[model samples]
Structures are given as structure tokens and as C-alpha cells.
Target: MPLDAKTLCLGALEAGFDTGYDIRKAFEDGPFQHFQSLSYGSIYPALNALLVEGLATCDVRNGDGRRDKKIYAITDSGRAALKAALMEPLAADQLRSDTMFAMAFVHLMTRDQVKRILDEYARANRRLGEELGRLLRDRMCEHPGHQFLLRLGEDGSEMWARCIEALRDDLVAALDDTREAPEAAPTGGAAAMTARDAPETREPGSGSRPGPDPHHPRDPR
Candidate 1:
């Protein structure tokens, strides 16, 4: 099931992010990096909805000639809501990636373009892996479950980076082979090979035990 922005924001608050910017940053730099993303477009409206529902409160902190900052905090009602949500049956996971889609049609792209794409992909995964590793090394969490989740995220990021690097090497070698055999016609076997070598469309988070589904009302577990 798709998670709503509002519940994710509430979870961010419960996790100690006090501002909308901080909540969004948490998604980019924290555990959510592995599985989900929420933009400012989603965040601000979610924050507003939470306020309207009386589940959270916000205080405006004036800045120096820039935009004022709003600090948010969960209320008692918000805590209850979060607990209820967490206790509910977890939703089915959904994975969506434009990178994977582009890679599926990689045969149509030039070697240079493929190189650029692989370089960018490797760079991004490497950065995420490094950040996750640093977070695990420097920060300590009291909750065993949270710690487990953090470790899982770190492992996933590192593995993804390594896999992407391996793919980059393979692609480079394949391109070189193709250049050396320019007269050879592309074969059906090549299509089969590409299909076999393509990355899994589903992301890493799907197989994990279910968590709360924020979009729907609680159902009996």
C-alpha cells in the first residue's frame, strides 16, 4: 500500500524531526532513503492537514529576512493515531524507479550515454551507502527494532552500490565487445541476455514484515 505523506510526517515528528524541512531531510538522508521519498510538495500539505486534524501543533520561528520556519510537534492525539496506525496490518509494498525503466531500454542508447547513466547511478548509490554507513557508526538508538532497521538500510545501500558498480563494469565490457564486432547483427539471444541481466523491478523493502498503512483505516489484524 502507498503511504500517505501525513502519516510519514507524523512518524518523522515521533522520530524527533521538529520542522517540515527536517522531516523532508530525514527522508533524503535517513532510513527512508532506501525505500521511500516525500517532496516539499507533499510535506507542507501534510503538515497543514495534521494541524487541521488537531493531531499536531506548529509554532512559527521568525528567520532573518528569509522564510519563517515552522516547528512541529506531535500531540497526544497524534501519538494515539501513530500507535493505532502502527498496530494496524502493514500494507503491500510498491516499488517505482525511472532509472530501472531507462536501463531496460539501454540497448537503444549510445555507449557514451550509457556510461554517463551508469556513472551517475553508481555515484548516487555510493553516496547513499556512505551516508547510511556513517549514520550507523555515529549514532546509537535505544530501540532494538529501530537499530535493526538502520542496519538493514545500511546493508541495502552498500549492496546496491556494489551491484551498480558491477553492472557498470559489465556494461563497459559489453560495449567494447560490440565495438570490436561491428558487423555482427544483434541477435534474439542478446535480448534474452538483457532481460536476464536487468535489475529486479521491485525494491529492497518489499519482503520485510508488514508495517502500518497510513492511507487506510485500521482493520482487524
Candidate 2:
């Protein structure tokens, strides 16, 4: 089943994240790890629902006297609600994301499609890097647990952004090479099909067909 806004809001508060971004990060961090995850796409709407229900309240902190930033904390009722939710049986986890599943087909995709995917991911990562950097430099350091969390957030975001940027570079290089060199025979398909059909024969001599030699590509005979 799906998680309702109220329970999510309460759980976030119980986890000690005072703002929507903080709560979002809590889901991404290793503490929750495989158990829970959410992004701004889920956070904002749920937070708004919580506010309307009077379960949480926001306070403003002015930045450089330019614009005020709003941070939220749980109310007494919110704490009570969170405790009640925690006492309940765990619900089955459900995740739905077509964008991620599409990534499994990167090798099978057209060159243009692969390039587009990498470039899109790079842009998204760069945006996240900027957001996390701003939060660390301007806001998170002053808070308690936030300092450590901000450090983790910075490292994680930077590494992830770098990885995506590297992939984009690799794809661009492949495109450049393809423009220069003539096409070669399609590789890996026939071998992959064979593997799929007779995976148990992978050890060699376990079946009638001979397996590929690990030491050399050419046959000894």
C-alpha cells in the first residue's frame, strides 16, 4: 500500500529533520537505507498536507537579510501521531520509477538515446550539487545534527554528480569515436544468449558444449 501524507510527515519529524529538505535527506541517508526513500517530489506535497492539518509549524530564518527561509518542526499532536504510527505493523514497500528501469537498457539503446539519458542525468546531478552546497554553506552548518548530515550530503552529492559527469563524458567520447571509425560487428549478443540458455554449463565439461577458455581467447587445439 501507499503511505499517506500524515504518517510520512509524522515519521519525518520523529526522525529529527526540521525542514522539508532535511526530511528528504533523512530518507536518502544510510539510516533508512533500503527501508525508506523519498525526494522533493514527495516531500513538499506531504509537508503542505501536514501544515493544513496543524501537525507541524514553520519558522523563518533570514539569509543575508535578503530572503527568509522557512523551517518546520513537529507539533505535540504530530509527535503523538508519529508514536501511534510507529506502533503499527510495517506496510509492504512499493516503489515505481520508469526512468531508473530504462537505465538497464542503456547498452541496448540508440547512441542518441544513451547520450540524451547521460546528459539529462548530468543536469539533474549538477542541480542537486548546487542545492546541497547552498544548504551546507548557508543553513545546515549552524544546526546540530545538520553539520554531520550536511557533510555526508555534500560528499554523496559531489561523488554522484562526478560519476554522472564521467558517464556523460564517456558517452560523448563514444559518439566522437563512432563519427570517426566505421562500424564493427555487433558484439556480446550471441554469447549472452548462450549464457542465458545454458548458464549451468558455465563451469565447462559440465555439459556437452565446450566453454570459452579463461586464459586465452584462442582454442589450444
Candidate 3:
């Protein structure tokens, strides 16, 4: 089953992200990044729910000459809930990427467009790896498990970037050999496509072929 935004918020609170904004960042680009994602829209509601359920506490404090800020912290109940959730059967990992989904429809794109997409994807992956590396260098993750996870994500991202860069030219070359196929080509293989692409139907009774006539007998000789 998919993890809910509320549960993720609890994890972020326990991880020392005391503010709603910080919680969102944790999933966007901090420790929770790469493994999980959360949107601000979901984060705020979850935080509210946590407070209501006594799973978390919040403190309002003075801000930089502006509205006060609310700092969130997980309660004992929240920690226990997080622990229980983790111990349950975990969901299988999935690769959720917009770039990857776009790549699957490459036939709809031009060669130049395809090149740009590949280049951008590689660059983004490289950036992610570097960011993770910086976190490790700054000693943000102290525990061995935390370090291990960051290192793993960093290495995996860097390796994938390299793989994409290496295979780009070959993928482009292969794509060049194949013509674009119709987006809505029916199933059942090429024959089905052929039937779909056949000449459009005209009037129900209108004869398309010329009728044989005595005046044009003997093959019109």
C-alpha cells in the first residue's frame, strides 16, 4: 500500500524538520528526497491532523519581523506509530519519473527534442547525486544507516547518469532506423495497423471501381 502524506509528515517531524516548510523540503531535497516525495498542499493538512490526534505538538514563535512561525515536533505516540508503520510489510519500490515516461513516447518527438530531453535528464541526475554528496560531506547524516542511505542514493544516481550518457548515441541511432508509428494504431500487429490506415470509406453505394462495358470490351484494345 502507498504511504500517506500524514505518516510521511510524522517521519519528517521526527527527523528534526520542525516547521511545515522544512518538512516539505525534507521530501523535496533533503533526507527524505529520492526515496519519498510530498507536496506542501498535503504537508500542511497532515500537520494539522497530527496536532489534532495528539501525535505531534506545535509551538508558535516570533519570526523575522513578520507573522509568527509554527514549529512542529513529533510526540511519543507519533514515534511509536512511525516505528509500527516501518515494521509492517513494505510496498515494492517503483520508479516514478516524468522524464522516463516522456522517453517512452520518443517516437512522437523530433531527434533534436529527444537529444535535449536526454541531456536534461542526465544533468538533473548528476545534480541530485552531487547534492546528496554535499550532504554527506557536511555530516548532516550521522548514523551509519543514514550515511548508508545517502551514499546509496548518490552512487545510484551518478551511475544512472553515466549510463544514460553512454547509451544516448546508440539509442538515437537505433531510433533513426525506425520510422514513427501511428499513436492509435490498433492491436493485433502490423495487419491491424494496415487495416486502420487503409483508404477512408466513402458513400455507402458509390462504386469506386469502373464498371465493365461492352463498348470497352477486349481490354479496351
Question: In terms of lDDT, which candidate is strongest?
Answer: 3
Please provide TM-scores, in order, for all candidate models, with all chains considered together. Answer: 0.66, 0.44, 0.73
lDDT score for residue 148 of model 2 = 64
Q: What is the lDDT of residue 68 in candidate 2?
A: 65
TM-score of 1: 0.66
Candidates' lDDT values, in order?
0.73, 0.62, 0.78
Q: Name every residue pair that clashes in candidate 2.
A: none
lDDT of 1 by residue, 88-193 (tens): 8878877777887887766566677888887888788777767776776777677676667777777776677667766675666555554444344355666444
Q: For all the candidates, what are their Cα RMSDs to the real structure?
A: 12.8, 10.6, 15.5
**Rank by lDDT, descending?**
3, 1, 2
Mark the regions of model 1 whose C-alpha exceeds 4 Å error after superposition. 59-69, 143-145, 171-221
lDDT of 3 at 165: 78
Identify the superior model by TM-score, candidate 1 or candidate 3: 3
lDDT (10s digit) by residue, model 2, range 1-221? 45565677577776677777778776774233334677788788888888888888888787786666668889988888777776787677576657568766544455677777767776775666666667667643665555566566566766766676655555455433433332242446653433233323233333332343322222236
